[model samples]
Target: MGGGADDADCGDAENKLGCILSYNSHVELCVVNYTMLAVSLVAAGGLLEAERRLDPSRFGRKFVWQAAAFMAVAAFQITLCFVVNCSGVSIIWNAVVAFNSITVPGDTPRHFLFMYLLAFAMALSLDVYYAFTLELLTTIAHLCSLLLGGLGGFMYLRAFPNYGRQLRRPLLGAWNGDGGGGADDDEDDGSTNSSTGSV
Candidate 1:
């Protein structure tokens, strides 16, 4: 009756993520959806920050690169939702599983379970906070991240050369070189010559 795998707490799903949704083989559960949404959000902010540092021009460059990065991440997320098809095998959802494994359900190292619950609570709290703050713009941004993340995973199968090549070509062609949509050619010209004209 002490610290065994068959303890009642060990058998409870609530001891894990407490997921409620179940679709089918597609997404099939709340765990995958929750993790994908979280991942897409994080990836979007990282992309925007990277672009801002690399090309700090504020005029309109921010708009173009920011948009593409969000869209690409979105596409990847969406494809992940539908195509991944099973949360049981999902890398994202299994993060919870792995964390939960830190404490055997019926074992004495109960602090790990406390840590997991604390982390989950904090994540859910932030989700609620952001949900209340979201508006039309951010909502669309979320949807686009879903679509782009999905597309990226899809293209991973086909092995595309660039991230969101199609999105960047049309949206950002005017801002960069490679002759208006470098869809067909490698983006580098490898020239070191520089000249300036003064009047």
Candidate 2:
């Protein structure tokens, strides 16, 4: 009986350790992912401003420096993932594919709505930056930064719920009944049962 209890205790300890490790891994991955995203966005913004102004100096020397910094951070993130032997390539490739696949089919209403909202936000940000800075060139640079930041934020929010759901559902299931039990109960009851049974 004592041996059995010891074995059970060991098993519990192992499980808890695994859970803690998994949680830490997820937190690390999220930080790396966002850091890379920010780096890419900043680099892209710098390039956009350089092109728009057609003058490297107008965007300022610091813009180029910032672009390099962002890329270095992104590289660090990639290296860390590779070192950890995590499935980083799959995540990166899937994200690229999904981004590329987002398109409007025959100019649908939703497509127009998305376009309008995006354009309005871009214009608004530009206007605000210009109004406050009173420098047309610097305003353009800032506007690009705002757009990139907004895109990163949007992607983070979209991915977060799915990630959180995956992480929590298993533990939640063990504590409560299976998470899908309510749905299963509803199905078992039959959606059409009330009207059809009596008739």
Candidate 3:
């Protein structure tokens, strides 16, 4: 097994190291994309259910509309990911297909759809961010990463204004088993009533 041809076939260890790194990166990126898709779908479904159960006095028409919009955007991203995966083209060509698929739209503005695309694109760049050094390009690229992530986060929070409250209330209730948040809610209600009465 040890000969000139075997030595050439095995090649240098450094070359093998690069291949190993590239293979691991692609595997990790696929894992991240699948995770993003799963979480997006869960968030979209939860928001839709919350909208359905919302009280008009607490959540007005505007609130409902925003919830719907957020849900739609999440669903749209999930759909695009599936489309790209099913197309079986290389990443570059799949991106072209995704662009055409999203832009030929109906009601929603093209620019807003681009924001959804930007969020996914930023997610995909996570691997590149890890691989690159801290230079000007990397700095600018990471800034774009944060901006897109923030935009998507803000939209989700806007759609679910009481999300934190609701999420924490359950944990609080479970921990104390007496609904610990009720007193704080009562105080808030009392303050609101008094302020409204004065008005």
Candidate 4:
């Protein structure tokens, strides 16, 4: 964890290796230092599982878009963080966390909403504080990661809301479904399950 808080050359041996390895020392704290690759794998798995639970069918088709979005976020954050703070930034886990903690179906229960907001607040606080404290680039990178995730999630729902499954809610509570949030999964997750019940 030799990656300093504000290294002049984040690419220097002491920082570059650490940056790429952990993306930044403050990231998973101690978890990423020794196992960055493992962490990335786990993040991706978690994202996929969460998506699977949203709609149990046609996971194969959806995988293409999900995978593309994941790679795009990771690459963008990594490049931006390294350039701005000489800090390596890995958005894989961050994006996954953001999407899961924030995406919820309507009628998802009030308790679930509370927990999601709590998690999001904590994450937002950290990013905002870092940005205010002179790590603006860090905040930017992190924000991009979150936005990309949220956007991709909405798109996913709009495209494939599943023809017969009962989706919890619309994207952000009012977008897809009769309101299509989930079919091509790109388009029926919101018309009220009085649906055709097609399999």
Residue 127 of model 3: what lDDT? 33
TM-score of 1: 0.25
RMSD of candidate 2 to true structure, Å = 25.2
What TM-score would every model get versus the actual structure? Answer: 0.25, 0.22, 0.32, 0.54
Q: lDDT of all predictions, in order shown?
A: 0.33, 0.34, 0.37, 0.50
Residue 162 accuracy (lDDT) in model 2: 26
* lDDT (tens digit, per residue) of candidate 1 on 1-199: 0011112122234422121123232232334455544543443334334333333454155445435544543344334434422112122322322222221122112233344444445444533443465334333433343344344435432442322323333322323343222323323211211222311
Q: Candidate 1, residue 111: CA error in Å?
A: 28
Candidate 1 — worst ten consecutive residues by lDDT sum?
Answer: 1-10
Return the TM-score for candidate 4, rounded to 2 decimals: 0.54
Candidate number that wins on lDDT, 3 or 4: 4
Name model 1 segments beyond 4 Å from true: 1-28, 59-191, 195-199
Q: Which regions in candidate 4 have their CA more than 4 angstroms from the true location?
A: 1-4, 14-18, 23-54, 81-85, 101-103, 107-119, 161-165, 168-199
The clash number for model 3 is 0
Please write out the lDDT profile of model 2 over residues 1-199, one tens digit for every residue.
0011112122233344332223223554334434444433433443334222332333454345434544543354345334432222212222222221221111122323244334434435434543574434334433444444445435533533322222222332423443223334434445555657831
> Which of the numbered candidates is closest to the native, going by highest TM-score?
4
TM-score of 3: 0.32
Candidate 3 lDDT, tens digit per residue, 77-196?
334324322211122212222322222112212333344445446444543554353234333433443444445545555655654333333322333443223445645756886989
